[model samples]
Target: MKRRDALKNIGAAIGYSAVIPTAFNLLQSCTSEKEKWTPLFFSVDEAIVIKNLVDLILPKTDKTPGALDVNVPQFIDLYAYNVYVEEKLEEYRLSIDSILKALPIPETGAIDLKYEDYDNLLKKYLKASKEEKQQYISDKNITYEALINLRNQSVWAYKTSKTIGKDVLAYDPIPAVQKGCISVEEATGGKAWSL
Candidate 1:
C-alpha cells in the first residue's frame, strides 16, 4: 500500500476505536441506575415515600408479612409508572409530602428525630411488645391514617397496572389458596369456611 494511504487508514482505525469506547461509556452511564423495581409513575422520591408508607400501613406482624416484604412498594412504583394518571401521581406525591413536612426534619433535609424517637411509641408497637404505637397514632393522628390513605391509592394503582398480573400472582396469600378453591377440603363436620 502507498505510505499516505496506509497512514490515512491507520488514523481512521484509531478514530473508530476511540469512538466505540466513548459511545459504549455513554450507553453504560445511561443504562446504569435503572429502575430496580419497575419505577411506578412516581418520581424517585415519591417511590421512597410509597415504600415507607406501605411499611407503616401494612406493618409486618407475627401473623403475616408486611407490604414491604410482599414487594408492595415495587408494585406501587410500577403501577404509578405505567397505569396511573398524571393527576393521581401528583396527588399521591402531595399527600405524602404534606405528612412528611409535618415531621421534624432538619433544614438540610435530614430527619430531626432518631430512628427510635417514639421508643415505647412506635418501635415497641412494631416489635409487638407494646401497643403504644396504636395509641400514639390515634393521639397524634399521623402515620397510620396517612398510610391507610397511601396504601389504598397504592394498592388500587397496583391492581390497575400491568404489573398486577405478575406481582399479585407472586404474592403469597394465606393458605396458598388458588383462584376459587380452598386449599384444604375438610369433610369432617365443617361449616364449609371460605376464609
Candidate 2:
C-alpha cells in the first residue's frame, strides 16, 4: 500500500478501537443491574433504619411513589458518605443510634417499629419550637443537627430522583423564555419544579 493509504488505514483502526470501548462501556452501564447500591458509610442495620425513616417521611400516596420506591435511602447514604466530615459522620452515627435505642429492637437485631412510630417522631421534631428542639437535644445528648441533616438529605434526594423529579414534579426539560414576573402557582400549577 502507498504510505498515505497506510496512514489513513492506521488512523481508522485507532478511531474504531477508541470508539468501540467507549460505546461498550456506555452499553454496559445502561444494561448492568449489578450496579446495585451498597451503602458506603452506613452499616446494614443503620441503612435499614435510614430506609424505614425515609419511607415514613415520604410514604407513597395515590399521587406519587415514596422515598423507598425512589431509592432515597441509598441516595442519602451516598450523599452522607461523600459530603460529611469525620465529626459530622460521628454525630450522625450517634444520632441514628439514639433514635434506634428509643425504639424497640427485635431478636433479629432490626428495629421493631412501624412507619407510624417514625412518623410520630418526625412530627414531634418538626412541630417543636426552636427552644424545645434545643432542649430536647440537650436532654438527649443527641443533636437535632443530625436529624435535620438526614431530613434535608432525604428531601434533596427525593426531589432530585428521576422518579420524583421527572415523573412526579413539574419537569421542563426544554424551558421556554424566562418569565421574570410570573406567579409560582401559575408557572408550575403549585407543583414543585424539578431543579
Candidate 3:
C-alpha cells in the first residue's frame, strides 16, 4: 500500500475506535439501569418512565407522600397486568411507545432520567387549558391521552395507598361523631377523607 493510503487507513481506524466505545457505553448504561427493575406489565424502560412521571405528578412535599413513596408505579404495573384485557393492554403498550418516541433521550443518556427531564414534558401536556385538552382528545393525540390516563391512575394509586389513607388523609377507625355535619375544611383540617 502507498504511504499516504496507509496513513489514511490508520486515521480512519483511530476515528472509529474513538466513536464506537462512546456509543457502546451509552447503550450499555441505559440497558443496565433499565434491567435493574422488572415490571409486571411494562418493559424496563416503560417502568422507569412511569416511575419518574408519576412522581412528578405527585411529587414529595413536606406534608404529603409522593407517588414513588407510595409505590404507585408498582401498583400501576400490577393493576394493568392483572386487570386490562388483551386488546386494552395492546392499546396501552402502543400509546406508551408513542409517548416514548416523542421524548428526547435523557441528558444523562440513560433510561433513568433526572426528574426535570420528565417534568418539562409533563407540564407541557398536563397543564394545558381545558380547551387544549379537549382539542387533544379530538385530535386523538396518543401522548396527551396516555399522560392524562397515567396521571389519573397515579392519583388514584397515591390516595388509595395504606400509608396515605391511614396516615396522611383523615381516617377515623371508629366514628363517634359525624363528619357530614361539618364541611370538609372543618372535618379533616381541609384534607379529604380517606377512601
TM-score for each of the candidates: 0.42, 0.68, 0.74
Cα lDDT tens digits for candidate 2, 50-145: 878787777899989887777777656654554445675687788788767655667676556566766766776766788988787787645355
Q: lDDT score of model 3?
A: 0.71
Instruction: Go through the candidates in order and give each one's C-alpha lDDT.
Output: 0.46, 0.66, 0.71
Give the distance in Å from residue 65's predicted Cα in candidate 2 to where it truly belongs: 1.6
What TM-score quantifies how close candidate 1 is to the native fold? 0.42
Q: How do the residues 1-195 of candidate 3 rate in per-residue lDDT, one tens digit apiece?
A: 864344344435675344333322222222224334467788867887888888778999998878777677877776566445567679999988877776786655437566676878787789888898899889999999899889888887677677787889889888797546667787788888875
Alpha-carbon error at 182 in model 2, in Å? 2.7
Best by TM-score: 3
* Per-residue lDDT of 34 in model 2: 21
What is candidate 2's TM-score against the reference?
0.68
Alpha carbon lDDT of residue 49, candidate 2?
A: 76
Best by lDDT: 3
For model 3, what is the alpha-carbon lDDT of residue 100? 77
Which pairs of residues have clashing backbones in candidate 3?
none
lDDT of 2: 0.66
Candidate 2 error regions (>4 Å): 1-37, 129-131, 137-143
Clashes of each: 5, 0, 0
lDDT of 1 by residue, 113-183 (tens): 44433233234333442365567566754454454566575454333332333333333335553455434
Order of candidates by TM-score, top first? 3, 2, 1
